[model samples]
Target: MTLTTDTPYALSAPPASLSEPLEGSLKVDIALVGAGFSGAIAALMLARRGVSVALIEAAEVGHGGSGRNHGQCIPVFGYLDEKTLPPEGFVLLRDSGRKVFKTIEELGIACEPVQKGWLNAAHDAAGLERARAAHAKYAGLGKAGAFLGPDEVEALSGVRGYLGGWVHRDGGHLNPLAYVRGLAGAAQAAGAALHVRTPLTAISRQGGRWLLKTPRGDISARAVGLTVNAYGDAAIPPRLRRSLVPMRSYAIASAPLKPDQRRAVLPGGVNFSDTRRDPMFFRVDESGRIITGGLVELRRGRLGGPTVAQAGRRLARLYPELEGLGFTHHWSGMVGISARQRPAIFEINEGLWALAGYSGRGVPTTMALGRALAATLVDRAEGARLWPHDAPGRIPAAALIGFGVQSLRGPLNKLRDRV
Candidate 1:
């Protein structure tokens, strides 16, 4: 089966409906913006609890970053320092991967779920030291992580690396789009109404409820959850939009590798990303294709031909056995980032909530956050404390700041990798 699309997840995703957009006025207990992972998961969890939920999406389900990501279910925050996470945050992050798998199994989602370990390879001695410290810190917290020696790293990931790194056993990979679609199906089955191609243009308070004006209709919700992430600029409140800097990320999938070629690479079928500043991540798909991605320049919101070619070169360099392997798919998506480098979950109003800035850890992190958000809305005090309920402070000239950061990231990463 083909593995590439403008949104690749649709290729193998179980058949799902486009869902008619909302028309006229409707009222619900909760109206979720963005039918991506976060919103879909929240809808499913809340509906399962008998809450009336309406999930509105500008585009079809999984069309955003949910369908475009690398699909690794990392157990830790990508951009946050381990020391920065509180004890409770550490526990949440530690079990986030398992939570994702558990949810999938409970829902009986058909998405391929793999539980092989995740390899964080160290490119240099300094990287090795950081990895060692990370492993030790997690171990101190009674988390499941271990530092791999050079030999162990090589055995787990069939590539030449200077030093060893850490492995999170609970971490794994999945088809992100398929998973999101599965969640959407589950939410709908649980009595949640899903409206696709229905972008929210405004959110205003109406008496005791929030009125969400959509292109096709308006939804009056007792509680609203904005989970649009990078696409929230026009659809969400200005304060929340100003706090996020959207960054474009790119990925490519090579033609299925020969059996010998696959064995020469990720023989253990574990997902991997190196410790470089501009780290590259790769994992073998069920079809034996090597899927990899990293930071790349975007033209008109998409990766240009040159950037895709550069990704192929980078992949070949990482695994010499895959040199000259032609890529069968190239795609790009936007990820919302915060200056703080961690996700933000806070109240937009008294009852309206918003969550964003998973950085690049959306796979498992979003799942965990979604569940927490659902619980919070349901008045579950335990879930209310899953993440801090404080506003992510505004960044000055967020658009300009995002542009500057993206422009410098590639070059700076290259320089850091050399050091």
Candidate 2:
């Protein structure tokens, strides 16, 4: 693989090639747009169940946020702008990560799965209370998220300044790009027709089937699922795209830390995210590099670069031993900011469905939701029971998001946390 500055560090090794676009017009039992986490899993499950399915992608598999996430695979929802979550959503969220890990073991995917657990470190006493509350909320649902006092927090992270934290042993981190690509490959081997660089340009209902238009040709499908999340294009309904506020998220991997430095920072190989709303999260890659991320400050369709700079500064503050290390990789991706702040399944029209808005929990949760989606498409009652979803709603001032609202996210998040 040709190395580029924008290539994520998680995919340091050569990647498995996804399928090239199809040649002629085709039909399938279900046509899934976006060969990311949800689409790949749905395609795999559907094909294995004796259903003909086409998993299509505008780019290669994991080309979107699926491959570009922070690699934290926790099974809890964060940043939902709702007062209460529906009961079914909780059940799905609780079981999501296990399904992801199970598939990894079953498929023997080499995505570097680490089961060391995740640390939600608190920055202060108030943050400590919030951490406890967050842990308690999940613990009530039968999750084994244990609360950590100051010493445990420091001991696990090998860093200072955290007053307390919570450790969820059930959750861990993995190389997301490798997992999605492996999943797409497994789906292809299982009889799902996988296509990359083949985008759905338009869609309509003809008679009883859905007509999907691609640059390749028009393909007819008995059912259609748009699993593009924040990457949806004109092919989907306006509401489906409009319901999300695409926020810019950035991540970077520092040049490999020395053995002593690695031993002193994130030494446990666990993912660590702080209690701030604009939270700081980091992990350790197999290369012994410190992988971390923050919100991007964009200017004229390009990165302003200060976001990664701030991330480096913040890391130094937390772990002064690595104060001068420079980053070897820095890249940004759009995270779907849901109107309600949680990922949900949506019905665009009869026989047409969408899975969008993962907030920050796409890695673990997408597998469960994707399997449920495919199960539902195959007319299994289990899917409906697994993820009964909410109706779509437009984000107020979502148009402003294209203006300066997205640029304002960093300031707003920091300001809100100050209050």
Top model by lDDT, which number? 1
Q: State the lDDT of candidate 1 residue by residue for 313-382, as single tens digits.
A: 8777877887777767878788888767788877867788888888889998887788877877777466
Which segments of model 2 are wrong by more than 4 Å? 1-4, 10-14, 78-89, 298-305, 380-382, 402-405, 413-419
* Best TM-score among the predictions, by candidate number: 1
Clashes of each: 0, 0
Model 2 Cα lDDT, one tens digit per residue, 233-308 = 7767887888888776767777778988888987777788998877778888877777776655554124435544
- TM-score of predicted structure 2: 0.91
| Pairs that clash in candidate 2 | none
Cα lDDT for residue 205, model 1? 92
Query: After TM-score superposition, what is the CA distance of residue 355 in candidate 2 from its true location, in Å?
Result: 1.1
Q: What is the lDDT of candidate 2?
A: 0.78
